[model samples]
Target: MTAVGDARIRRAVRAREEGSDLPGVWSAYGGLLQHLRIRAGLSQQQLGDAIGYSLELVASVERGRRPAKAAFTAAADRVLEAGGVLRVLQDEVDRAKLPRFFRNVALLEAEALSRFSYDPLLVPGLLQTETYAHALLGAHFPPLDEEIVEQRVAARLARQALLTRKKPPVVFVFIVEEGALRRFVGSDAVMHQQLEHLVTCARMRNVELQVMPAVRSVHSGLNGPMVLLESMDRRRHVYVDAQGVVSVRSDEDEVSEFWLRYGMLRTQALSTEESSRLIERMAGEL
Candidate 1:
């Protein structure tokens, strides 16, 4: 499961378990640990044998009720041939209040050198204004209790720091459909504020924003909203968020195709100057 999905489930479970939300999020950390063991071709008994735990303890980890140790993660990484992906996140997990899955994404984002995104519906989380984000989050079913909403929004807003940090600024390129620009997600005032913020954010040196005109007959982004993230280590991942599903892929060919499509879409989009003017015009209509 994606980190966001894991976080959703963790929130539900936590709400029930504590009778109120706690600041710490621990989505399916146990399950991820167990899956790593299974993928490493180790039986539950074998994993228990290596980690000096009973098979029942191992089972508890799989069920998300218990926290796995760093030593266990290191041992599992070696056995699983994960090249320290688990180890790196394990370190951050120690200090993080973010859910397990979200922590993984944070580690990945911290290492990323560039990101390219397309959003056909709402603004991407990394770029959302607080008001816009809160309004959208409030609409989620099983409605995020106030504390959870606050935490999630704060977490997302914190991610924007990547744009300004020293050296190798996280290059960001965004493409949004004209329809997204037209939608008034919140009140007219809130939506107008968000659009104006988009205009200012787009002008940042390391950021690029483009709008896909609704009238275009031939477009490369027909498949819907997707993101292509690249790290300095030459790794690539494809992320798609649609129909209440968010997925990330590390498969080379799969991400490569999305990268190619993003290139084509960029070519068809209006120049940055034109897009800014277009956004400003839309903001005026509000």
Candidate 2:
């Protein structure tokens, strides 16, 4: 069990004791767990002991204030003789761990035949190293529980597996701004490792890496970052995330405009060789 909102946990526990309807999926899951625990004649502390967690953690999860990990659900299923009832919800819980809006993008990326992205703020998830990702998520403004941070980091790393598939996308292009590379994330050592990883990824046969030089006075991507996906059926889509909102567009006219802008970005950005050299130099500087 991970520490979460203590006040909410207490309120939820009271609601469960009072037999009120649980509002959300997480709350429903917690209510079910509590019912199972009572039927099994196990106290929260007893369940915690059986599951190798603390009493507070068990109570936190039971109140819907903490996300239940897959391992915890599996153990609970067995301990409570749930006959796979709890285990069945593990996938749903895992998916819920990801930011709600980005879920569709994750699914689409897996099916895309070709993928291209231009990132100006930070390293794209697919290109980020584990350390870089951990540092990035750890700095969340509202602050996430350690468990949630690790869950998000795991989700981000899992997305990178697409690039290593036996038959990956036909073309994978990443256009990173020069300022993005120079931005400090984590520590100097972490940045060094991340840049080295970028250099290695650039060498992949199907991958194309380009850098938008900082010296450039004007560029087509000045508006913002965008990702274009070409599915196996030849359909194209564009994904854009501004602030916290995410939009995916499949309209031909809109996607074509993005495609044309991407072409211009490619023309204006440094070649793969030059980008790799720059990345190597940056890594060496660290």
Candidate 3:
């Protein structure tokens, strides 16, 4: 009788877990997609064919098992005549793909007029290549599901769009430790590609990339990685990420200190031209 009671409890717990695990926004988007398709008298296969996607892909999206990319959403919306409703959910759907801890920061970043970051270890997510990001997440200690990994990778790439946002473009400053550049997040080829990509990004007029030499014995950035964001209203915020934990501060005093530290780190690090040359050299060595 006790064994049967325990079995019932286990089943109840599992059911509740499954309920909480559902991707709410993705599911809503999926349901809307289904409604639109059905209203148009189109089967999943027919819709997939019209949108140039596979039937399985369409079915997966309809079930919320996969989040649709912006391109996919646009194509589907056009094909289904969604009248822009599907496109409206694209931001929320993309935000859901990022880890919960980073979502708020991501939102603040989108509104910022300038972003400055000091990365002592891994390359900042904003600047990471897809292959590099995949390898980094793939090495998470507890192990992430393959699907979750894909979602995170796609989400990371999505954030890179901010790099090119125009009409009063955002300014970007990146200070990366030399060691982080040398560390192999993925294969040698990936590291090489990433360094080359960095060089490319640094060439952008709105971006300033600097390299902190490993030889620097002591520096404030050694404390960990921190991101500084200045909103259009000139309000500044500081974001610090250590391990998996994160802290965000809006207090002027605290944020000002972070700005001071970042300024020091920038001066201590290589100039943009030098950094670009160094990155090019590193890519060549790989």
Candidate 4:
């Protein structure tokens, strides 16, 4: 698990107990605090000096031990010389959008130049449509009311905007089984629309989609789905989302193992062209 995992899980359990969904907000704010502190090259004590708080307070926020107040955010923005970078996190926190695990994923996506994603169950967030997102979120947490459901949908849709931005990042999505396409989340109409969208999105220059058909006798990804994000500075991080989010080390050994696994999965999967045709045919059946 990464630095955010235990804290997020604790927050999630607490939120359930409190009958609130504020854990995600708190997690995102915590991520922002870490990012700014690192970017500003400020040690805990230095950050405290800049923000007029004890180092313990800053540490508490970074660990999600405390909720970030509006004043703390504003002060951090100025002290970190972030201009308005930290302010962006405020909007998501204010809306209480973005899942606790996904808040870290979003931060990585924003800074990444290329992302390698493998999904064993559903499509990745950067590729999901609003309708598909709603269906998935509803299934993930069946008790959510209409209001929270809509907010989750909006949050997922907002993630897709990453692909359309001026300097969009490269995305690679690998799927292990075709059943993910057959399992209709919403109605047939919604599933059909989503598959069609996937076909279109897969054709984009920066996006690469592949599939490991069930017919394959063996697969390296049987261990599970993992994503590797490469930053512009050439740093690589592998993230796996299960019950929670876990980030693999950038150490050569770990990254090499993931690369080997990912390479084997791709080799076992159908070609991009083949996957595209398969998706189109599945959409037709829908």
Candidate of highest TM-score: 3
Per-prediction TM-score: 0.66, 0.74, 0.86, 0.68
Evaluated at residue 36, the lDDT of candidate 1 is: 68
Model 3: CA > 4 A from native: 1-19, 43-46, 52-55
* Ranking of all predicted structures according to lDDT, beginning with the best and ending with the worst: 3, 2, 1, 4
Best by lDDT: 3
Candidate 4, position 137, lDDT: 77
Give me the runs in candidate 1 sitting further than 4 Å from their true place. 1-103
lDDT at 195 for candidate 3?
A: 91
Q: Which window of 10 residues has the lowest lDDT sum in candidate 2? A: 1-10
lDDT of every predicted structure (CA atoms): 0.74, 0.84, 0.87, 0.73
Give the range where candidate 3 is weakest over 10 consecutive residues by summed lDDT. Answer: 1-10
lDDT of 1 by residue, 187-224 (tens): 99888999999999998999999998888767988888
Error of 4 at 26 (Å): 8.0
How many clashes in each structure? 0, 0, 0, 0
Q: Which has the higher lDDT value, candidate number 3 or candidate number 4?
A: 3
At residue 96, give the lDDT of candidate 4: 47
Task: Compose the digit string of candidate 3's lDDT tens values, residues 1-286.
Answer: 1354345435534543378564566776776777788878999999999999999999988777788888999999999887897898899889989987788899899999999998888888989999999999999979999989998999999899999999658999999999989988889999999999999999899999999988887987878899999999999999888777889999999888889988899889989998899899999998
RMSD of 3: 7.6
Q: What is the lDDT of residue 143 in candidate 3?
A: 99
What does candidate 2 score on TM? Answer: 0.74
Give the range where candidate 4 is weakest over 10 consecutive residues by summed lDDT.
1-10
